[model samples]
Target: MNHFLALTRRGAIALAFALTLPLPAVAATKIQHLISPGGIEAWFVQDSTVPLIAMEYAFGGGATQDPPDKPGVGNMVASTIDEGSGDLDSKAFHERLDRRAIELSFSITRDYFRGSLRMLKDNKDEAFDLLHMALTSSHLASSDVERIRSQIMSGLRRDTTNPNALASRKFLELEFANHAYSRPASGTLESVPTITVADMRDYISRVIAKDTLKIAVVGDVDPATLGQLLDKTFGSLPAKAKLTPTPDVVATAPPQRAFVPLDVPQTTITFGAPGVMRHDPKFMAAYIDNHILGGGGLSSRLYHEVREKRGLAYSMFEALLWMDHSSLVVGNTGTRADRAGESIDAIDKEVRKFAQEGPTQQELDEAKSYLKGSQMLQLDTSSKLATAMLQYQLDKLPIDYLERRSGIIDAVTLDDARQMAKRLWGQGLVTVVVGREPQAAAEAARAPGAPPPPKAN
Candidate 1:
C-alpha cells in the first residue's frame, strides 16, 4: 500500500470522527501557546486522533513589499522558493518530498506571504528540516526562475480575456488608485518580465523574518516537542523584517459605475464601498448584517432578490472584506450582457433599501443562529483548523476566540445589526461591469438626439 494513500485514508477517518463530536467539544479545542528556546513562537492544537501534522504560517510584507516597478517579486518568490533549497537541486528537492509524501507550498496575498506543510508524524524531522531549508536557503536558480516567470506571464495573458479577472482588476485599480493595494499581486505582464533572481532573493531576505511571523500547528504533537521543532525550523531567520511602511487607505474611487468591454456572453460585475476593520468593535455586528444581506448563501436577501425574484442572474453575493490596512463591503455577480444593467439596478436597489431599513428581528435572529452553527465547518479537518487559527492570529484575535465567538454573534441585537447595516452599506457601491456595453447605454446612444457612445478604454 502507498504510504501517501494510507495517510490520507487515516486522515479522512480522523475527520469523520471529529465531525461526530458535539460543536461545543470542537469549539473548546485547547490551544497551547508555545515559545521555543530560540524565541520563536507558535499556536499549537494537539490532536492525537491521526498521526499527521499540518502547519500554516505567514510573514508580514507580502506583495506590498515589492518594488513599484517589479510588483511580482513576492509572488515569484513564493512560487520558486520550494523548487530547490540548501544542497538539493530542484529535482532532488522534489524527489525527497515525493519519497516522504510531504506537502509544502507557498502563496502570497496582498498583505501576507504564506506557507503550509503537511506530513506524517513519523517524518516530522525531515519535514521540518526541509521547511527550514526552504525558508532560509531557497536557491532561486536562473532556469527555475525563468520557467516560473513564463508560467506567470502566460497566466497574465489569459487573464486579459477572463471577464471575472478583468472586472476584479479594474475594480481594484479604480478603487485604490495611486495606492499599493491597486497593484496586482501576481505582477503584470510587463512587471513580471522585469523581475530578476536578485529581486526574488532580496524579497525573501527583507520579508521573511521571525519578527513578523505567525504560525499555527495542528497534529499529534505535544507542546514540548512542538517548541523544539519551532526553534529548529524558524530560528535561523533574521530577528526582524525590513518591511516598508504601507500607509492606510480607503476606497478612493467615486461612487460611480465603470465598464470594461469584453466579448463574453455573460457580464461579470464587481462592486464595493468602504467597510469596518477587523478589530473594530462593530465588526461582529457588520458580520451578522452582511450574512443577512448576502453572505448567508441561498438564504441571503441578495440571492432571493437578484436570482429568485428577478431571475436576473443565477447567483449574487456580498461580504465584508477587511484587509490589514483597509476594509470594504464587496460583492459580485454575473448576468447576460443585455440584462447587466437591470441586474445592477436590482442589486443596488436592494443594497440601498437594506442600508436604510436594515434587517428585521426575524432576519437578525436567523442570521445569528446560522453564523453560530457554521463555525464547525471551519474546524472539521486539521488543515482547515490550522488555517483558521493562523488567520485568527493574523487578525490579533485572542486564542479563546473560538469559544467566545458564538457569544459575540449572539450579543449583536437587532438595533446593533441595523446600525451596522447603515454604516456598512449606506455609502453606496462603486461598480465595475465587464462585458459588452449594457443594452440601456447602447439604446440611449442611438436615440435621435443622444451624444455619441463613449469609446472603450
Candidate 2:
C-alpha cells in the first residue's frame, strides 16, 4: 500500500509507490516465470503500483503461415477475431471494450501473429474473459469478412503505385524467392477475394494453440494469480499447433542491381545483404558495428556520407532485420530520380569503407556509449517491458538478458567490431531502386534494342 510489497518469499518484489501508480526503478526489472497446470508458460513482471495491466502474446505462425493460395487469411483472422465472439455480436463485444476502457488488438507480422491487451486492474477478469472468447469462439461473421477483404484489397492495389511500397515489395520478392517470405503478408488483390469465412476459422484452428503461444504480463498481478489466469485464458486450446513447416533460408539477393521504373520525382531505394542472426554469438559485436556503420542516424557512416556530406539523398540507414528463418542487413534511402545513381555510389562507398576498416576506436567507443544509454529508454515503460520480455523469449535469450545486455555490448573489442563489420557488410549491398532506373540500368536497357558497334580487335 505504501512503499514496498514483498510479492513472495522467492525474491519476487514490487515497489508499491502509491495505491495504483508504478514508479520507474533504477534497478534491473525482475521477471517471474509462471507455468499453468495446463502446461501454459508465461513471464510475469509484478508491478502493483499502477492499477493497470498489459499483456502481449505471439504465435510462431504469422502472415507467413497464410496458404500460398490465400496470402491474407492470417491477417483476416486477426481482423475478425475481436469483431464478434460466442454470444456477443461485433457491436456488443466492441462496445463492452469501449465502455470498460479495455484495449484489445491484434497484428499479423511476417513471422508471428501478435496480440496486445491493456486494462485497469479492476477490469482484468472481464478483459481476459473477453479475450478468451475472441481466441476460442470467434464467429467470423460474413459481412465483416467481406468488408475487411475489400479494405485490404484496396490497400494492396494502392501499393502498386506507391513508390516506397513498390521498392519494399520488390526487395522482398528478390530477397526470398520461392519462399513464404516472398508472399505478401497482406493478401494480394487476387488472393484476398478468395479468402472465405471458413478459411478464417481454419486458420485459427491450425495456428492458434498452446504450443506456439508466448506471453508477457505486467502490472498489478502476482505469479499465483497469473498462473490461474493463464490456464483459464489459454488452457482450452489444442496442445499443439498444426503449423506449416517453413524451410530455412537466407536472404538470396546477390550483389546485383534491380529496379522498378516509375514516373516519380524521387527514387526510393531499399538495399542490403545478409546479416547475423539474433542468437548468433557475434550479434552483440555486430550490433555495435552496425550502429557505427548505419544504425546511428546522422552519426552513421551511410547517413554522413550519403546525406550530410554529399547531399545525394534526403536520408539513408541500414539495420539488421532478423526473421525466424533468415537474417539481413537491410537499408533504404530516397533521392531525386535523376540523382539516384549518385546516392547508390555514395552508399556503396561508405559500406565498403566500413566493411574494410570497421569502426575506428573512437567510433566504437561512442557507439557503445550511445547504445548502452539508449537501451534503458526501451525498457522504461511497463508496456514496453512486456513487449521486450516476449521478444527476449522469442530470440532465445536467457532470463537475465536485460541485466547482462550492457556487459555483452561493452565487451566488444575493436577487433571484434572490425571482424563483425567484415562479416556483415563484406559482400556489399544488394539494392532495389523504385522509380526511374539509375544511370547504369538506363544504359543496360538500351543494349537490347540498339544496334551494337563492331567488336574490338
Candidate 3:
C-alpha cells in the first residue's frame, strides 16, 4: 500500500510538470483591411485551413428609425429583400441557394439591421454574386411584400391571445410608454398595412449604403481576392448613406399594475421599469450584482430561497434590459394558485435583502469567476466573435472592450455591486406573475408593509 501511494504521488507530480511545460505557439490571427475600388471598406480574416467562409453586413438605421406610422416597416422590408430580388424570383433564389448549399439569413434589431451569408469555398464566387444582388437590387416584389406583411399581422393578432406574449408586450408598452423601443420588432396589425414598396425601396437604399455598412469576412481566401470580391459585392452602392435623425428615447415614469385576470391555469405576469443601458457607467457592476441575486441560476439568491428551500416555484430569474433611453430589470416565476402568495413574498424578501445587504465576499467571488469564465467560452467560435464585434461596433464601444472585459468584472467589489443595486435596481422592482391567480397573492401585493415591487409595467 505504501509503495502504491508513493508511485501515485510521483505520477501526480509528473502530470503537473507536463501541464506547466511551454506549449507550441499557435499561428497568430491576422485581421486584414480592404478598401474596395468603389471605396467600401471591409475587414477580412483569412483562414485557409477551413474551406468555409462567413460574411456579415450591418446597416446603421435599425428598427428604431422606421418612418412615422411605419413602425414595423424596417424589419418587414429587410425580410422581403431576400424573398425575391434581382432576376431571381423567391423560388429560384431559394433553389440556387439550396444547390450551392449556401446559408443566408437576415435580421433587424432595435439598433441595427444585419445580413449574413456562409458558403463552401468552392461556391464562394457564385454565392457572393447572389447575395450581392439581393442586397443591392432586390425588387421588393409587391406580392412577396404583401404576403410577408400579412404574416406579420397574423403574428401580431396571434400575440394578442397569447398570455405570455401579452404579458411581455404589455410590460414593454407600459415601461417605455411612447418610446420607440416599446414597439414590437414586428409592427402591430394597424402599423403593418401602412407600409409600401416605395417606402421599402427608399429605406433599403438609404440604410444599406456602403459608408454605413461594416463588413466582416472570415474564411479561406487571399486578402487581395477577398477585397475584389467585396468590391464586386458592395462597391457599386453609393459611398454616402442617408442618415436618419435617431430619436431620443426618453424614460417614462414608473408604471402602475394593470393585471388582466384570465381563466387559465397559468397567469403570465410582466412588469417593466427603467434599468440601465449597455453603456451605462455602472453596467459591469450591475451585471456582477445581478448574477448573485437571480441571474446566476442555481447559485442565485432567488433560486436558493424560492425553489430550493421553500419549494414555492420550480424556476425564478431576473434580467436587465438597457435600451437607448431607458432600461429595466424584470423577473418572473410561476407557482400553484395557493402557493403564489408565498412565492411572491419569498421573492420580494430576497430582493429587499439583496438591496439592503448586497452580496457577500463568497457570492461576489463566485459571480466574478463565473462571468470571466463565461466570457472566455463566448469567444470560442467565429460566429460568436462576429456577433460580439457587431454589437461593439453598433454601440460604439472601445476596441479593447473584449480584452478589458475581465478587468472590469474583476474590479467590481462587493460594495460597488451593492451601491449599484441600491441606486439602479432599487428603483422599485416590477413584479410579474404568469401563473394561476391567488387571493393570497393579491392580498400580499396590497400589503403596505410588503416591499414595493420594482416599477410595475
Candidate 4:
C-alpha cells in the first residue's frame, strides 16, 4: 500500500494563515450577584478550571475613622484581625491556618479596610469559616493589640528620620490640611498609644456596615453556593450600612518649595497637588494623560526628559492617589544632593508644558497603547479580576466598566489630556527635599535654630 500527500503553495499558505488565527473567545467570567436574605450583597464569578477560590471583604471604615489622637488605630485593627479571632488565640489561629494551608490577611487604607482569603476549592468551607470568624468575631486581644501598636509606633518614630517617609508624611499633611485625608493612615505616636479596644470595636461596627461590605469571590463556586457561603459568613453582621462620610477638600495653597536637611547622601524630591477623585468623569482621561506625562514608566515624558536624556535622577513621575472625596497627583524622584533641584525643575517644566499644550498625537497614541496593554494584563488571574471588579463596585461603577474602559482612552484626544493636565496641576506644589550637607549649601536655607528640616514636600 502507498500513501501520498500533495498541496499547492496557495493551499499551504491558506493552512498556515488559518493556524495563525486567534483562538476562540474564552467566555469572560461573568459577574453575578447573590443577595443574602439578611440583605448583604456579594458579587461573584465562577471559573471551574482552577482548584482555588479567593474572596475579599471590604468596609468603608478605614484609617480616616481613627480618633484624631490615635491616628494609626484603624491600621492596627486591620492587621490584628487574623492574628486572633473568636475562640482561636493568635497561636491557635496560625496553627489552624497552617494545618489547612489557608492564606488570610487584612489591610487598612485611608478610606477602607480589606480582608482577603485564598484556599483550595476543596478546603474552601473551612477556610471561609475561619475567615468569617476573623471578620465578625475577632478577639481583638489586648496582647495582639499592644503588639501591633508597638510595631506601628516604632515605625512612626523611625519615619521622622527617613527622608522618603518624612517627605510623604509631610506632603499628606500639607496637601490635605484640615481634611482627614491629610492625616497619615498610620496613626501618630500620640494616637497609637491612646487607642483602646473599645475604639477598635466601635470603629469596626460603624465602618463595616452591611452596605459598606463589598464581597468579591472568584473560583469554582456556583452562584447559589456562593450566596449560601456569603450568608453563612457575613449574614449575622449588622445589616445597617453606615458608611464613612466623604472628607472635605480644603483649598490648599499653591506650590511652595521647601527643603529639609537630612543626614543622607542622596536627596528625595516630590511635587504636584490635589487631583481628580475616583468617580470623576475626567478620571479615565487623567489616567491616560498622566501615563504620557510620567505614569507610563520609561515611555513617559518625565522619564524620557529627566532621566534618559538629562541623566538627572534614577526615577521620576507622577501618580494619582484618590480617596473618598480627596485626591492628589504626586511626582517624586531621588538624585545626587546637588542635582536634586535640576530634577525638580525638569519635572516642573514638563508638567507645565503638558498642562498648557497637552500631549502630542504620538504621545497620546503611545499612552493609549501602554494603558490598553496594562488593562488586558491586569486581568490575568481570577483573583486580580475579582479585586478589580470589587473596586468598581465600591466606586459605584457599572458592571461593564471594564468593557467601556478602552473607549474612554481611545476617545481621549491630545487636547483632552492637556486640559486634564492644566486643571489638575497645582500651582502651589509643595516641594520637599531631604539631604545631608545641603544644610550649608546655598539651596539649604534652613531658619536658624529650627528643630530640623521637615521631610520632602
Q: Flag regions of model 1 displaced more than 4 Å.
A: 1-27, 439-457
Candidate 2 lDDT over 1-457, as tens digits, reads: 0001112111111312221243476126588787877778988888865777888898888887899988989988887788889899988988888777677888888778888887778888888999999999988888777777777788888998998888878888888888998888888888888888888888899899888899988888777777888888998988899999998788874687788988765778899887778878888898888778887887988888888777778777778788888888888888866678778888888889888998899999999899989887767667768878888887888878888988998899999989988887788888998886556445543667755422211
Cα lDDT listed for each candidate: 0.83, 0.79, 0.68, 0.72
Summarize candidate 3's per-residue lDDT along 376-440 as a digit string, tens digits: 56644454455556556555676556667788888888788889877654555555554445675
Clash pairs, candidate 4, are 69-191, 70-191, 71-187, 72-187, 254-428, 255-427, 255-428, 255-429, 432-456, 432-457
Total backbone collisions for each predicted model: 0, 2, 11, 10
Worst 10 residues of 2 by lDDT: 1-10
Which residues of candidate 4, in runs, are more than 4 Å off? 1-27, 241-244, 250-253, 426-428, 437-457
Q: Compute the lDDT of residue 366 as modeled in candidate 2.
A: 94
RMSD (CA, Å), each prediction: 6.4, 8.8, 11.4, 11.8
Where's the lowest-lDDT run of ten residues in candidate 1?
A: 1-10
Q: Estimate each model's TM-score.
A: 0.91, 0.90, 0.83, 0.87
- Report the Cα lDDT for residue 262, model 3: 53
Q: Is candidate 3 or 4 superior in lDDT?
A: 4
Q: Which scores better on lDDT, 1 or 4?
A: 1
How well is each residue in 1-457 modelled by candidate 4, as lDDT tens digits? 0000111111123223422332212126557776766667877777766566767778876777877666777787776777778888989987787676677777777777876776667777888798788878899888888887888788889988888888877777677776777778778777778888898888877776676788888777777777777888887778775654665684365677666778665688877677777788778788877777878888888888888888878677678766666677788888766567677788778777877777888888887887877775667666566677777777788777777778877888777777887787636366777776554533443447644433322
The Cα RMSD of model 4 versus the native structure comes to 11.8
Model 3 quality (TM-score): 0.83
